[model samples]
Target: MNTIKDQDLSKNQLLVKNIVEHAIDQANFTIKNLSKRPTVAMLMECENCLTDFMPVVKFIADDHIEYAPIYDQMCAAIDAVQMGEDLVEIEFA
Candidate 1:
């Protein structure tokens, strides 16, 4: 799992992580193609928000089991930030 600096996570990270986690959990086919791993592009209305998150994560996962938990953790971290809470203990299984 990757923990991006709090200062470097976009508002859309929360949304995108949520969406990606859902997709991973629900995708019917085995995610066997490492070269075609799912990519998430965060879209923001404000350029400032767009500038915060790192644009991409490479070598993110080799399969769904690895990807799902990480995506869930990322979403949880972003949610904690949005709720005015400290993300002091975020981790993936």
Candidate 2:
């Protein structure tokens, strides 16, 4: 199972990760035109203890849908790795 094992992650971290992931997914599904570009605002939060991690809203995507999705996916994957088991073994399909 895909997951993250963040030993030092607070609740806010998890929240931020979730929001970013959701935004990325939404962008992928909602945005159609590659030229139009899709943007998403994410609120960062703690992982272990839910809290206001950051005050400023994080923005994803500028004008390149392809790059945005790739970056988002990488960020999400990294976050998952930090939150999952200490010894995570992923099997890509």
Q: 4-88 in candidate 1: lDDT tens per residue?
A: 6664567445655664444433221112221134222211111212123212211243233545555455455445434534433
Cα RMSD, each candidate: 17.8, 16.5
Best by TM-score: 1
lDDT of 2 by residue, 1-25 (tens): 5346654457546665566555444
Ten-residue segment with the worst summed lDDT in candidate 1?
41-50
lDDT, candidate 2, residue 35? 19
Give TM per candidate.
0.31, 0.28
Best by lDDT: 1
Candidate 1: where is the Cα deviation over 4 Å?
Answer: 1-63
What TM-score does structure 1 among the candidates reach? Answer: 0.31
